[model samples]
Target: MMPPTSSAPHSAGSAGALLTDARLGKKPAPRLRRYYLEPGLRKELPKLHQILAVDLAHVVMLAERGIIPATQAARLVDALRDLRADPEARLRIEPERGSMVLQIEAHLTNAVGESDAGALSTGRSRIDQGATVRRLYERNGTLAVLDRLVALQDALLALAARHSRTLMPGYTHLQPSQPWVFGHYLLGFANKIHRAFVRMLEAYHHLNLSPLGTVGGSGSPWPLDRRRTAALLGFAGLVENARLGRDIQYLADIAAAACLIMNEINDLATDLQLWSSNEFALVELDAGYCGTSSIFPQKKNPIALEGIRTAAAQSMHWFSNVLALCRGMGSGDLAMRSPGHVDAVFETTADMTDLMTGIIETLIVHPSRMGARAQLGWTTASSLADLLVHQGTLSYRQAHHAVGAFVRHCVENDVAVTDATAGLFASVTGLDMALTDAEFRSALDPATFIAACTSQGGAAPEQVDALLRAAAADREADRSWLDTEQHRLASCNAELDRAAEILAAARPAGSHHHPDLAHE
Candidate 1:
């Protein structure tokens, strides 16, 4: 219903009263249900209602029939089942003079039960139903995105394994500071993605709790079996209080999940953009994933990466929009009908999944180019500084300062550090040492330096292998989780199919007293 309006009382005795008394005044227009439900959501609106009505009708019928205890019919179960069957459902909101009313309209194409009572009767309010639908959509939506995230991780792991010994120049301040295996570098981002997946799982768990039975931000007089519906809809449990179910805290939790997805996508896009730049050029995106320039035929822009970056930024902004929406509303303003959070969440989540999957699937790794670049640019110079510290010739601070001076001298004089003599080293650092050409060569070899690092996450091939094995195991676990979730969803859908048939068969019967009764 539209926001409340103002009206003044008229004196009953005059001609004005007679003129005004002919009818109960014009009825307010039905606020199109889709205005709140359809703007950004992926699921169609009508289908959502069909699914919801059927499932809830079954619950109502069972309760009416005494086939099951009233406690077995949960609003959460009905909402969940409805979403699975038809992600888009529309309900009617009829506002009278003093109070608002809700009922599901009959005779729609998807309508199964002919009995108007099956669709129109509601022991609960639309506020709880809407909240429950949003929550179910969010929880499942995140799980779907998480599946893609883990798949991308698998792709990154494969890249790391393929390039475990492929060297690349690792930079600080846009200049080469050290050399590392490309696999080692890729694994760093993989770890970040892995953590993002974990965050998604945490959000999924929180969203899984059912909020369906709460009526108008308070408990209803009619008994609502919160837990049984939770089980039917695959929710772990209920959030308890009706008001708490639609509370700001619950909305914020949903928003937090959206932020997490956006952040991960932004981080990925940023890395891809930097790596694809001409200045870095350690890797070139495949032409299939790049866009052509309007003026420069030679320019191959990483538009997908850039688009992903922009989309992620936009999603975060929308998350803030929803948060602000929450701030503006009252503690129990259930009638506001701002399901923007649901729409925003589904759109952002779907975009994230598409971007993550696209990036991983089409990424082009150039091990040879990365290795050639790594070997150039004096990237091993840092090793020389670290070597001096290891040899106890200087403290790390002294060695750092000495190396900085040497780098400056070589850059100014247009000379290579390898060409500098042992006497030059003595002159620069005042170390009483006579180093040979072999020593200079050894210090400049990045492969030698990397191999010496034997730590858990080091660039050494052996260490990379160990980490890769662990990541592979984790990926397997992630796959199993996805499969289990899919199976559960499939079971929910199957139940809806059966329930739809039962309702369809019972529609023609004249004597059925309840929504859930099976047809003769």
Candidate 2:
């Protein structure tokens, strides 16, 4: 008793139909739509709205230049406003109807008249629109990740400030080689993060160029004001060459920036994972960020640190995928506009930033354990060698040999460095290195060794304090930059809204051009 299901192919009876049928099909398979097309459209809807806002600005400019009729532009702007107000309208997009843009056009035609809705696409192509959307997305994503990086830097500086005198062993090839304050170790990572911020800013500069007027990878036929559109959309300038505007190089640049950030996160996670182990016990994470073994109640695992490492590794994989997708593809290839590839790059980068920020903000440090470990493996051996070279009559090479022999002697006798004596020193160097007991003990003390490293950028407390101050200043500058960027974007949106309002007012009251104008 059920009616027969309609299997008729979708008819190419309109502009939307023509574009959709050419790229997809009259009727795409359900699995393809569910797996690729529908998901792509859903993800692209927000970006579609953003690009449409810019397109409305373009239409306004065209109207001011007498390229489009004033009444038609007003009606188109009204339809755009209607679309903006209704979030559900974006979800109404069907795969058989074409891309999100085409569907939006179809919606506009239904809301406004066909003539005015069609006029909106007069001087533009999907190529330019797609490029501009991606640039905007990347620009916003870069600023967001940069904000997180600054916060992480702030957290690190705070921890470093608190631990300026907290002694820890500096390692070389997994072996304790020298004594340094934990603050100095933290400052090293902070500097690397600052560099990552700089690199992201460079990439942001490149991606800020507007591509809205580079129609179809060549140029628009109409006399369009590219700079005007750029200013209206808060872009720095135009991409200039149409072909280059369509290039995927900017995406690759973003990927590279992401790779830098993830690499730093990986390094930090590696350190935290090692330090939190039972053998090291140098730091303990907060219970909120850790987990216990399902079968063993005694296990407190640093699960968040492990997750950060995994996320960082996944970011590298996403970067590789983006690079491979763009490797040899010529400029303006449709494949370069793949939504899944682009989304993976942006989403993974943002996720990694958030993960790292959470990890840095909540973890706890144990200074006593760090100090205890700082004294092991003869961490002050280099200081002792330097003391022999300077305070005793020995060549530098002779001093090194003496320190090597001394370490071997300690190993053989199983004696701690703290228990070393003048007799032991004389036996190793084969000379009566004259020094009082206090002086000999001072040379082997980790705290004394750290204090004696008064060179610039050393582990000395004063140097660590100076580095913390520098990091604070750097964080302030980055905060100022972020504020400026956010204000610019906000101002652009306000300007666009004002422009739309002025255009909408120009239409005659109760005009038959668009009925929704009154309600809007």
Candidate 3:
């Protein structure tokens, strides 16, 4: 009775064309009838259609199975498979008479036809269509983000290598604690990024499931191969339950991934902002990533780092918003119907990815400055403590306490730790007449201290070497995954191009041609 789930989504021919024209008042851009078909919107479309394609194929299979008639199934199948650019590239429509008034469309052509209603809405409602679109977005966006993360990892690796021998003062409690290789310090940040990457990759798997066939709040009665569709889109599989698929639970994975990425970015940005300041000046960022100051002409502001910091704050807020959106709502459709959740999450993610990629591309090293900073402040004081511990005059715990006392005395007396350490050691042990120059120099040489740290995960060059090698292998694995994704996207583009060519050929010679599908 409910219009028999009409075979076609819209009316056919000139009427269908007018249906596109009907929404012209809403979108002043004079573009596609569906906003999603606009250049900007189309750019956001996901590649997981390889999954949607499968779902649609199953719909065709349903028709083939005689669950639906041959003509209707063929039309639906054709609509699904067709990749023509929406003629109404950013068109939206509002029908005054119907409950289904909020419909929008994109690049409607032969498949959409002259019908006022087409197969796009035949067996499914906009609720289901929106869900499918969202799934495609999440799946593809996750893949893209992972790729960008890999690039960032590569950039950090190169930076670490470039500054391997560069020295820097390691800090604790806002005071210099020890001397370490610049590479070792850079690798510290890299380790954080690596862990974040791993968390995101695991989150991606959670986001990669298909939600396409979960029609409306439930699912279609017709037989559908959700698994086949997921495989097509490269998703792990469908969300097993229909109601759960449409619930806010599905979107939470994306939110978690966004939070992890922004958290990592925030930490790194804060560290860079602090280190790049006049007070620290341990590293000099490239001019390309900086900005001019209006009030202060000499200011070479680290705008990139600042922007990342700001973006991270916004992204964290987005994660909260997403979680809040899912928190109190009822089951079925009411649980998470907010449009902003998907849109904001996507925007924040896209912004973060672009910003991070740019930072990686333009980042520079100032190893000499870093090393010089490390050389000051009996930064080697810790090594002297280790020396005492090694000589059996004191245990590590006792040495730690003695070092603290020595540091306090030096600070109060306004003398360097070396000056105080000899007297303090002699006072404590009543044995040392005078610590040798060789001993003092060995403790002071940041390099020797670093090399002496031979334990696992120590700042010793060898320990850092092991970490660096492991990071390299991890980076290589990330690159390999990126290569696979790149190949997949390439194939999508090729298919899209082929579809465009086919459309161009099918059109009447005098008909206006659509622009070619292209990437930025």
Candidate 4:
């Protein structure tokens, strides 16, 4: 909303007036329409119906409090219901209007006559109403993302269960460093996505609060039933500080959470892109997700991975821009509070997550290729070094140096480490080794290397199984919370509908006036 030049923002002059021409004493510039008014109408067109949804609650609360005549409120409710049932059919844009809500106001006034339609804004400002509406819409967006994340968690856990002991090369500095269980790799990302679930829930807690009844950043003179309206709207509670209604810092919080999800997505997408390469050949995306080059018939590019990566890359600054727009500007600068890009951030991240979920569900993993890669680059050398320290009288450093020398000798002689025996290590290092050939060769075996990882959070099969169970438990909790919130919102909608219907029915067929309803 455009802040007023004089009075506090969200005031009659700033927000509620249909008299932009009369108050400003001039027509809005073409640039104002070109940039803000026209685009806001088009961009907000899909949600124009929501204006009635908010106003219904507001009108019902007004009639219940006897702030307006029952007859007038009934006329308004019936009109609101008609327009809301088909907003596109009932509402149209006029170039003179400054906002979509203004267009709605003009349309509603026309439908039910001026006095009754105008009663909807009695003790509220568009600032709080828009904030409430944005929160409600964003709650829907957040839950949508959570729904996708749950699907992703299911996919990850299922794949992890299938590959619990599937040994693959673990990488550091883009080089093979150790043998890692494929299940462990997937579990790590599942945990990361769950963290995003937690953060979004935290955002939802703040976003679910009601901002209604805060008229122009000050409490209304009317004995407004703020709590009642909040209940009707399904808000968790009221935003008690009227001034905070104008503080949209919660948008930055949501953006920050989305940024984290995108970061994890980028990491996974980049790794999968690298893994799907001909050289790595460890994993292959489904043909449905891959795009073939028109010029190169042999190419089956992982376009979905590229798409996920591109989506994440562009949204890294969503939260940053939100913070930038909100900070240093005082509360009176209401326009700074609502950043539009956060919606795009959530939308893109949800798409990326959903796309990745499909990729995971249909992914093709080459166990043979992963096994081969796991064995190359002397990935099991650390096992040999540890074994030497335990069996021989060498300190840890001495054992590491001895193993390094043996590795270099094997490379020079074109000997695979798997082919080396105790005699070969002793002959190369001239060290008296207590280990037998079987024990020495076993230390270099990838399967033995995996079995030996008995630490609390190791690559061992038991450890991965326990972690998977924990992930399952956490995912179940998240799914339950999402379900509860969805049901609550649905219940609130039903309640709001029932309340509007009752108030609309209070008017008689030929009743002259509702003097009793004013105080009823």
Each candidate: how many clashes?
8, 0, 35, 0
Report the lDDT tens digits of candidate 3 across residue range 1-520: 0111112334333224333347653323333323322332333233324323533544443453455555444444444345323312332222321222122222223334423124444445545555555666666666667776777778778878876667788877868878878777767767776776677677766666666677775788766656644554555567778766666565676677777778887877787788888899876678988998889999999998888788777676665666676666655455323345466665666577667667755766677777777777778877777787878767888777776776666677787544554555566545463577566666767878888888987777778888889888988877787688668756644554343334334434454322221110
| TM-score, prediction 2 | 0.92
Can you write out model 2's per-residue Cα lDDT over 368-433, one digit (the tens) per residue? 878988888898888878887887588878888988898898889988877888887788668676
Candidate 1 C-alpha lDDT tens digits along 1-520:
2322223332321102312145756433334323432232223342254336434644644454444444333332332344344332233222222122222322121223333323333444555655666666566667767777787788788887888888888877877878888788767777766776777677677777776667676676665566655665667778787777665445566566667767777776786689788877767677777899899988999887887777777776655766677777776574245444556565666666676666666678777778778777778877777878888768888888887787677778876745766567667667644457578668778788788878877878899888888778777778788889888866865654565445434333353222321110
Cα lDDT for residue 462, candidate 1: 91
Question: What TM-score would every model get versus the actual structure?
Answer: 0.79, 0.92, 0.77, 0.93
Sorted on TM-score, best first, the list reads 4, 2, 1, 3
In model 1, where do residues sit more than 4 Å from their true spots? 1-25, 29-103, 106-120, 334-336, 339-342, 417-421, 495-520
Off by over 4 Å in 3: 1-59, 67-83, 87-92, 95-122, 216-218, 335-338, 417-434, 485-520
Is 2 or 3 the stronger prediction by lDDT? 2
Question: Where's the lowest-lDDT run of ten residues in candidate 3?
Answer: 511-520
The lDDT, on a scale of 0 to 1, for candidate 1 is: 0.61
In model 2, the runs with Cα more than 4 Å from the true position are: 1-36, 89-91, 512-520
Candidate No. with top lDDT:
4
The Cα local distance difference test for each model comes to 0.61, 0.76, 0.60, 0.81
The C-alpha local distance difference test score for the whole of candidate 2 amounts to 0.76
